[model samples]
Target: MLNFKNIAIRRGNRLLFSKASFIIHKGQKIGLTGANGVGKSSFFALLRGELHSDEGEFSMPPNLEIAHVAQETPALDCTAIDYVLDGDRELRQLQQQLAAAEQAQDGLKQAELHGNLDHIGGYTAQARASRLLNGLGFSTAQEIHPVSSFSGGWRMRLNLAQALMCRSDVLLLDEPTNHLDLDAVIWLQDWLGRYPGTLLLISHDRDFLDAITDHIVHIEQNNAEIYTGNYSDFERMRAEKLSQQQSAFEKQQREIAHIQSFVDRFKAKASKAKQAQSRIKSLERMEIIAQAHVDSPFNFRFPAPKKLPNPLLKIEDADIGYGDKVVIKNASLSITPGDRIGLLGPNGAGKSSLIKVLSGQMRQLNGELHSAESLNIGYFAQHQLEQLRLDESPLWHLQKLDKQASEKDLRNFLGGFDFRGDKVNDPIGPFSGGEKARLVLALLVYQNPNLLLLDEPTNHLDLEMRHALSVALQEYEGALVVVSHDRHLLRSVTDQLLLVANGKLQVFDGDLDDYRLWLAENKKTGDEPAPAAIASPAVRKDERKLEAKRRNTLKPFMDAVKKSEALVDKLQQQQIELESKLADPSLYQEENKESLKTLLAEKSRIDNALHQAEDNWMVAEENLQQAEKSCIN
Candidate 1:
């Protein structure tokens, strides 16, 4: 158990939180939330013993093993899988000792070290690390890739995998899902749900918090308060408290007004002067109740487009990808006025590819792409943040967009996004990622485009800003196509769901719940199957017949099994070749150490891939056998 007693913390003369008292019982999942610069990260630092509280005390069990994601990962010439496995310090130590024992030809010590390795599950460490990589959306081929080969976001994912690899009593994760897609986010949710440890998570994702956390620790007004419920429950409870506070404040204001009025009327009269003075004293002694502040700092809406085209954009039999590699093919889509679409798929499954094709950022490899003569597009992607003029202010950017607009008007518009006073004139170079994201959104919204194409727009947005964006999208009178990991935004804004998977684009007939089921099935099958479209009564009957048709139903499953088996066979053969090279005596020389390391890493990745492929094959075969039995019955 971790206990905090009247804790007070200050950073650079700014008191962040004071009188914070809370006890985190064993295995409690607490969602830590506050606005930016609210010391949430500082509290985490205090917990990790990197910083000490200015006053009060916090204590936890001395022997508890704490794990946290590293903020930075140095570029190292090591395989990603090996880096993840290194998280288990004890296992790495054992491996080191084992290697030395073998080098020394000490049979007894080698045998003892092997026993220790088995005891710690060191033999399966690579497989465990590989699973973590796969769950976080790394492809099989990428597992053996060098750590330095990945981009920053992928490096963050590697950091997350390393944290999860630790065997700890307490886990701390800050913005764990920022770089994940919807599918990977769902996978991480499941993984955290099964984690047998106390968790302190700091994230701006409301649905994610509600799904995984049982309690919320909110820091505001120099106080950290604990609430007994999920994020939704906490909101409800906080709203009620604030409502009561507002009522009390209003009643107190009425009394003060009455007292002041009486005092003004009686102060001129000698007889009532004493009574007025007594009332004044009473008024001074009464505690003033502050008004409730429920408003978000962000308040803005998308301006309606000037023109509404019947069909804003259309794609006919399009092939989308880069160079010669096709990510999605044979896709037909039509976007008209008032269309709201949310794309759903696993990472690298072509969600962004479709968006790129639609936005004209990437030309279609094949097919006809059409747009209205007067169509205007507002495209938002992560790279756009880097395109902003860092040396210029928000006001300058807005002025550049419209030279004739009044400065006061532009400042008012920027204030809606919380860029008030000096912030409006401050150079954007020092702005946080979230601020830059807000600025990009402000620019996009100001454009008033008939078609909005957004890719992961909520990546750095806070909860309040996300809410404002959702509200704005709900009121938007134009077509929208968005890809985001934020389920809350997707549920609130999107009216249609399009899935980008299996090199095809299709309308999903169901909601997010049904999408989850589809994802589970896809994971089991090792190949994505098209979801059945919404059916009429006659069509439903035909669908039943289709399922019962043994040959038709069993063929896909058999094919999947064969595909997985062939993949396993191919990987195993490569594994054999790598092992033969590794077995050569010359390969163990000092000059060949790097090559040996690469080969061993490849061998580990292949072993893990073969195991997964075999498991997939087994699942496919079992499903086929069950379908055949059903037909016979």
Candidate 2:
């Protein structure tokens, strides 16, 4: 058991929480939740002995084995499975001792060590490590790969696996699902449910917390309060408490207002001065109730698209993949104006490939893809965050998109995403992942695209931002197709689920719960048979020839489209500059009359040129589409 008595903690000069008292009992799974930088991680540090309370007392069982995922993984040549096995320090120590005993030819010592190994299940440690690796989305083949070979995100998964491999009395996991897919998240959820230990988890994923935790310790306003139930229950209880708080605050305000009014009316008269003084004393004696504040900082909506084509995009008998390697074969999907789709699949199942094809970021290897002329895609993927100019500000990015938009309007829009004040103008290079993700999302939302294809949109977002996004998506009129590990977001925002597996894109027959069951069954049965062998050499040769011919035929039309687009962009920029000059009040003064007239004339000329350029762009785009159709036919 862990007990805290009026604990006060500080990070530098900032007081995180004070007078925090709670008892975390054995075998209890508690979720620590709060806004970012609200001392949840600091609390974990306290448990790990990296920090000490500034006041009062905190106590835990002595020598309690606690396991936590490492934040950084050093590059190592050791195989992944071996690295995970190292989590069991006792098992490793026993093995080393037994090996030394064998080298020394100490038969008696060897026998004693073997008995101890059997008692601790050391013989099966390797198999246990492998299971942890597999459950965290690693393939049997990847288990042999060196730790140094894995990417950063995969390394994080390995760290998680290693932490789970430990047979500890207590476990601490923070944002365990951030780097995982839905299938792996489900697997970890099940694993944690079966873990015979006290678990303290810090996660922004509400569904994960609900599935794994029995109690919630919420930190807010420099206070930590333990609730009796899961995340949903805590939300309900908090809402009710806040409501009562609001009522009391309102009642207090009314009483104060009444007393103030009486004092103002009576204080001027000599006879009523004493009564007014008594009223003032009563007002001073009354305690002020703080107003309830439970509002999310994020509150933005997708602007309505300029045009809503019925079928925004369509794919028929398409094969999506890199050159000669097919990831998704014979895929057929139609996205209309209001389709809400959530994609589900195991890691590396080509869900992202399909999204890329739909977004026109990748060309189909075979078959037809027809996009409406009015289709405006607001595609968001994790990589796009990296594409943002780190040296620039959020306002700069928005102004680049629409220089004609007023600064006030742009700032107001950014404020909805919580990028207000000087923060909007600050360089984003030093921003955290969540801030970068919010900026990416803010840019996407400002585009007013008819189709939204998001790949793991909630990866770095907090609970408040996630809730705000879910609410905004609910009110969105555009078609949304998202691939996210967040089950709560999926359940709230998507009406249909699509399963991507076995090189096929098909509508899932059931919801997320059914999908979870399917994953378990599929694991038992093994992966769907490997995608059918590649086409014959002669057939491949012919397909390559056809692809080359199509590319050759579309080159001129594509070039024309690009040229027209550039011209339109150039003209719009010029127009924006001219309009900006015209907007200055100083330019309208007598001394600047001639300059204003010239600016207005230039603006008129640029507007005409921009209109012509826009028309040319449409013509070129139409020609390109027709050429593509011809090639398809």
Candidate 3:
């Protein structure tokens, strides 16, 4: 368990968080969310002790371990199996120490070895290692591949595998689902749902989070507020909280207005002046909550354009692959102007490569990619930041793209991405992935090209920022081609879908989720689809109602689980303090006898409460399982 107390983060002169307090507990999954550059990742780092805040304290059990997974690690060199197996460092160390002792035939060390082996559950480490490796997206075949040979996305899978293999007390994941395919993501969600350790993950995948996290921590205007539930529940709670705040603010405003009216009328009467003044003083003393408005990062719309004569863009009999290994083969699709298109595909299905070919960054090997005349294109590549010059400042980078732009114009554009003043002057080198993506997007908005291509542009962005981008794209009068695994994003901003799978492009005229379901069907072994397989309308409605009922029934249990999570935090804190005192030999001395007794007593009480809470948590979980089963059948 860990607690972040009174923490503050700054980007240049701007404060990201101030005196924010939050706690993470064992077996709880917490989601950190906010707009881009609002310091969610920074907060994660602060909790992990990777980044220090300018003020306040972070407390955790001294022995509590944390594992953080990045999108990719450039330094990885071992095979994926080695990377995953390396997570069992403690087991490996113990084995080495035991082997050394055995070689020396030291009886005292042998007893220590047996005790350590028994404590670590050494007999089960290997089985756990394999099971975790599979759960986190690594197949047995791929595990033997050298990490260097893997793509950035696959390398990310290795990071996930490693983290799960470690089975640390807490997982501090930054965009853990960024590279995962739907199956892998679902597997991960299920794994986390059943996991006993604590999890704190930042992800843009809505369905994944909706299925997993038990708590949501929203960081807004330099503070954090905790909510209980999944992403959807968090959104509902956020709206309710904001609405409540607005109601309170309105009441305060009305009271102040009434008092002001009374003061204005009674000022001439000397006797009523003191009462009016006291009312005025009361009005002035009322501290209203600031307007908690969330303006997403990108929020611009393009002027509507005339419909295209035919398709805005087209691909004909294309083969997308490296060399002879074709992924998308003989694919053809037409995109109309002003169409919001979602590109769906599994990993290694050539989604990005196809987008690249369509956008003219890469040419097709065997087919023609045709486009309308006078077409202007804007592409948000996966490595859009790589296009930026490292030596240049944020403003300078913007200027590099358009040297004719004035400083005033450039600064205003950067401001849209939440960069301002000295932040605009900050070199590109230190900016986080979200910042870099926003910078690239800011330039794109200014350009306002007719054809926009986006490739997983939402991964690094937080909920608010992604919503902003979605709003902007939704309003844009252009042909959009977005390749992303984010289900919510696709649903929000896309009109239809162009699915790439089995070396082909299959266009679907429906919602993105429907298209996703279609893709899922294509991958399934069953001859009949779920929709077609259901015999009666009663069964279909019952199934739908069942799912809804299960999700609803879990909400109250989640709330109770959240309360127990708080208790766990307090118990962990008490445990840490007790351990610190116990570590000191002076506590056993007669002079410190009373202190020892008190500490021990407090520890015992805390331990008992923690035990009870854990039991309650188990019961809540069992209840949820029963509810889910009932909903299913």
Candidate 4:
């Protein structure tokens, strides 16, 4: 167990926490939460022994193995799986020792080392690492890819995979789901739930916290308090406390006022002097209850558009992609005023590409895009944050949008986003990602566009800001198309779900929960985009005739493939049962000779059947592959 006893922690001269005591028992999954700068990360640092408490004690087992995701991944030529395998230092050491022992002709030592390797699952380490990679959304083909080949966000996932690869006693994850897509996030939530170690997670995603954590350690007002339930529970508990606090504060004010009135009226009279003195003494001894303040820093909203246009933007038979490459083809969509559409799909399935097409950032390779005569678009993408004028202040940025607006008015608007005083006029170069996001949102809102295209808008936003954005978006009069990993934001703001997959745009029939089920089913079948049946309008008749002919020709081969898959699955299950029986040591006892023989015979028979089944499946798969190739040709 980890214990913090009357601990006071300080960063620089600021006392972040004083007399904070909390016990994190073994195997307890706790979600650490607070506002952006309330020292949640510092508490993690303290746990890692990188920082000591300013006073009091912080204690845990000295031999405990703690694992955490690396903040930065160094670019290397190593394979991703090998990078993950490196997380198991003991396994690497054992392998190295065994190799050296074999080279030295130390037969006894080599045998001992091999036994140790088996004991530690060294042989299956690569398979375990591969599973971790697969669960994190890396394909089998990408597992062997060089670490440096992946983007920054992918590298962060790799780091998280590496951290999880360790055999740890305690795990510390800070915003582990920030870079992940919805599917990956779900996979990770399941994985962490099954972990056998103590977990301390720091995330702004409330849905994620609610799913994995059983306890919440909330840091607020320079104090860390432990709540006995998940994030939702903590919110409920805090809300009740705040409500009671408000009531108590009002009653206290009335009591103090009444006491003062009595003291003023009777202090000059001898008969009431003692009573007034007693009231004054009681007032001095009483504790003042402060009122609850739960105001969100964000108060801005999407102002009404200048012109309401029906069908604000339309894409007809569009193919969206980068130059010379098609990511999504045969796509079509219509955005009308007040339409709230949320795009959902697996990572790299062109959600962002479709957004770009709608926003007119990318020119379609084919078909046409139609926009209303009075169309106004406000687009927000992650890359657009880099496009901001770093040297300009928030006030200056807003002034550039409307030069006639007064500085006081601009400042007041910026204050709604928590950019007050000098922050409004200072260069935004030093601003954090969240601040930059807020500024971009502010700019987007100020534009009063009739159409909004947002991609991962809540990436760096806090829960309060996300809540504010959701509330604002719900009241927005303009059309919206948002692609986000935040499920709460998606569920709260969007009314329609559009699936961007298989190079086609289609309306999803169900909600976010259904989308998760769809993801699981697709992943089980190794179906990435579900193979779009795309054809141009000009070739519709011809394409239908060709498709019918191809289907007729491929039916037999497809049937054969399905039959073989079923046979393989059945044989595999029988083999697993046979193996389970053979694993029983009692079958080899003196009185069980007949049973032993029977089990061994059955195991051998099942093994032969499995081999034959696999062979047939391979042959059938080869025939299908050839048929597909011929049909394509």
Score every model by TM-score: 0.79, 0.76, 0.66, 0.79
Name the lDDT value of residue 620 in candidate 2. Answer: 77
Give per-model CA RMSD: 13.9, 28.1, 16.9, 13.3
Off by over 4 Å in 4: 245-293, 528-633
User: Across residues 199-277, which tens digit of lDDT does each residue of candidate 3 receive?
Assistant: 8877766667877888988887788777889777776655546546656457445544643553354334323322234
Model 1, span 200-237: residue lDDT tens: 99998988998999999998879899999888777766
Off by over 4 Å in 3: 1-23, 35-42, 45-62, 70-77, 97-139, 151-153, 179-183, 204-207, 240-298, 305-309, 393-414, 422-427, 508-633
Residue 140, model 4, lDDT: 55
- TM match of model 2 to true structure: 0.76
Better of 1 and 2 by TM-score: 1
Expressed as tens digits, the lDDT of each residue in 1-633 for candidate 2 is 999999999999999999999899999999999988889999999999998999989999899999999999999999998899989989999989988986996644654665677667665576589789989988656777999999999999999998998889999999999999999999999999999999999998988998999999999989999999988778767765765666555654554464355335433531332223433343333222111123557768887888998899999999988887776789988999778788988788789999999998999999999999999999999999899999999999999999999999999999999999999999999988999999999999999999999999999898888877875775578899999999878876676778887566776656677787788876764323222123578966776687677678888987897798788768755754554455455765688868866765675688688768766765776676567546544
What's the distance in Å from true for residue 624, model 3?
A: 40
Better of 1 and 3 by TM-score: 1
lDDT of 4 by residue, 78-114 (tens): 9998899999888999889977975896544654565
Ranking by TM-score, best first?
Answer: 1, 4, 2, 3
Candidate 3 worst ten-residue window by lDDT = 285-294
Candidate 4: clashing pairs of residues = none
| Residue 165, candidate 1: C-alpha displacement in angstroms | 0.8
